[model samples]
Target: MEYMDMYKKWLEFDEDTRKELEGLDEKEIMERFYKELEFGTGGLRGIIGAGTNRMNVYTVRKATQGLANYIKKQGIENPSVAIAYDSRLYSDRFAKEAALILNANGIKTYMYKELRPTPMLSFAVRNLKSTAGIVITASHNPKQYNGYKVYWSDGGQVTEEHAEGILKEITSIDYSDIKTMEFDKAVDLGLFNYIDDEVEKDYVELVKGLTVNWDVVERVKDTLKVIYTPLHGTGNKPVRRVLEEIGYKNVYVVKEQENPDPNFSTVKYPNPEEHEVFTRAIEMAKELEADLIIGTDPDCDRVGVVVKNKEGEYVVLTGNQTGALLTHYILENLKATGKMPENGVVIKTIVTTEMARKIAESFDVEIMDVLTGFKYIGEKIKEFEEKKDRKFIFGFEESYGYLAGDFVRDKDGVIASMLICEMAGFYKLKGMSLYEGLMSLYEKYGYFVEDLKSVTLEGIEGSQRIKEIMEMLRMEPPRDIAGIKVKEVKDYLKGIGDLPKSNVVQIILEDESIITARPSGTEPKIKFYFAVKGKDNAEAKDKVKRIKDEFLKHVKL
Candidate 1:
């Protein structure tokens, strides 16, 4: 159907809803109804509006109905699904609506009493032995955006096969025929059950088990001054509780952002990747003379960190840099304690820095590179568990998501926050700042600096433009980037790379620098990842600036 037809349907809503739809202009309606929300590797994410493509009650109902249909066809006896939501706008209502729809379909539902992180939802699905799960969250998207992510029985986001099946069911559903029961009626029917505290306790205990050396944590617990901020999302209570339980006494939470605010009142973007999100936290750290500052994105799936350099200036570390630091720290500590597993593997995305691979190699650990999604990492962890071939050590992506263990099959900012603080304490005990440790790591390894640029393509036309640009790049590949000769081109779409098939392209320069171009799955954008190695810190910094400048010149962004 045309967008105008969708717009007319939206206008036919009841009084209040019709008024709301009428308030929006033609552009708003067109943008909302232009295309259906896609189920990519990241699941469904979109702006909140009154259209089939938007994330509203009707869309949620349809998605839930389809999920229920898929579960029924699977022939699982007494199939149940777990549901959870974040602190975003209408997340609670959406969660309840999803549960009610599933319950009305004769499927059991286990939902959290309140908002929770995405990882907790993943854990709950496996703990409750449910056939599937739904988390009403957009991870770290801005305030205007929301999403719904589905998970399989193994507690990982639904993979391609499962997603395709769910999409088929979704396509077969008639929007008007999808049934939804009242929340109270669903509760009375005994099909709805609220998850209890025992699950939280179990999750906390599982996270505690990820620790390699509690003694190190206890040694400098009081001495290490650390600042943490959840960026006004679902991570506040759990992260703080974990830190306190693990014996970190000097942890300080940013007061301004301690509570959940759907608008994310303090920052323009709730994402931790942007340094501006850490402005207030950095100021607080400066006042307290703290050694480390940590920030987690809204859903608590991604974490960012800043540390004081030797020059007493705070430097926000890239996701790859932070991941390398944490990975090296964990593996080295394990090796020192004689606990390094011979058959251990580290997982990362193809766009992530190769420096992590180099670090893992020094410890004789294997590295597995996957497409740009944590679900792939989770899938690998599940594989390792089943095959008993290798232990999953650490998993991270270039977008500030990290996981230390298999406790939860997702990028967990709660655990990442705890581990990052503990690592800071480890360096504090050695009479060095985290930044100094980073420098030392660079000195031992080579100086590796990585950067990323995202180009947003809005509206329907923007997507077509993105496709045209990718085709142009593929057909007429750049021979050189910034006066540097292109040594190799790895096109993941054709599966011609060090890894499998994906819609990504990597260019290797003569200087050993690397550049990757890939489209974002959740949002309409194109991302460029650049990595350059230098002999020393000065050389690395200069090369990063030069490479970034040259990259912009070539891409003209």
Candidate 2:
């Protein structure tokens, strides 16, 4: 009945929404209005459509109203917000709607003049000293989806406590109570302002400054052939500019994917994690005889890489692989240049490869393992600032997200791409490819491989099934997986030692092999992560497969 009410309310919308909903079947109507689009810790994300469960102007305004109310309660005199959007459909419109709604609620808004990557929004929040920030992007989700991610003045995703407060405020307000002003009126009233390119220049300069050895890059600038693709998102301009200005003359952009396209015409999805997203870039690399390829997701928060093996075939690197390689390079360079600190630390998620730990230890740098999300890593960065106990060297997760500096609290592809190019250049100077660099890391550390498998469960019933699966695993926990004895079980929900409580479980084997299961916070899926190390590459991969196959038997997929 509630869904039916929302369906009726949404039908009173504009002509396009009304016409779109007029012909929906009963199932379609229920699917679109069964419940409000979830505003989780990640903020609002959903398929763009006409109902309460979809991402539309009404929902965006409602969320903004809630955020405004929360800000007012914080007692910040004349609070402000920074806003940015990506190339997704309706992203710009949603961003403008949010800004105006904030303006109507008596808050100043600093919005980007055009589409930009998510990390820039993070930087803008701190640079502009705004009360909060919002970026309209779904990250790497399909084209049907768009999102609104909120960040505090710290330039990181809103804290869990903040998420709860905003949610309470959101629930108290009715959809009809949402306020907004015209864009022109907001601009005239001095409540709305556009951020200029100077901020971009500042951001690019900071990224370029992260280069470890520009001397090597300059030497290999003309010889190192690099291919890059933005995946039709927001990374094209900034990434290209940073590389070019930093002295890479042989960089080639994938022409077909260089510009914004909401449809993501050439790939199944804009996710760099999927090999399919690199088809165009790989072709360009092979034709150009490039040494390396890089691709970033839609919002450019996460990045992926491809490198030529000794056999001259392009091999895609997993997020863990890239993170490991970058870790080794950064630490090695720091020590060589005598910039290594006594208290430097490397942070990674619990599900990431243990190779990061091994690599950090080899360099005598401490490795800190946080919870799965990058926000926890960001929280640690904030903690480091207040305590000044440890200096952050690098942070990454298993999902292609990485960060080297604390200038931006979130994962940054712009900086990651720049460092990756520098790393490749450093290797080229030694007559080795990035693949051979990875091989050397494995040679020193044991061979480690990781795999991630996701089982998507959609709709109301599917959500229930997901809950059931999780409960079963917790109640009857696996004693052993694939003949390896279970050494210990870490149930993150019960609140691990110092980490926040989360709905995730990990079974550690006697051999130190690890398996983690958790429901995705941003999508309707439960992801399983397997990490194992063995004497060689084939053994490591085979152990992962065996462990994954055996673990799936315990849960109903």
The estimated TM-scores of all candidates read 0.97, 0.99
After superposing candidate 2, which stretches have Cα over 4 Å from the reference? none
Per-candidate alpha-carbon RMSD to the true structure: 1.6, 1.0
- Which candidate leads the pack in lDDT? 2
Candidate 2 residue-wise lDDT, 449-475, digit = tens: 998889989988878888887887788
Cα displacement (angstroms), candidate 2, residue 440, comes to 1.2
Off by over 4 Å in 1: 23-25, 497-500
C-alpha lDDT (0 to 100) for residue 234 of candidate 2 = 95
Model 2 compared with the native: what TM-score? 0.99
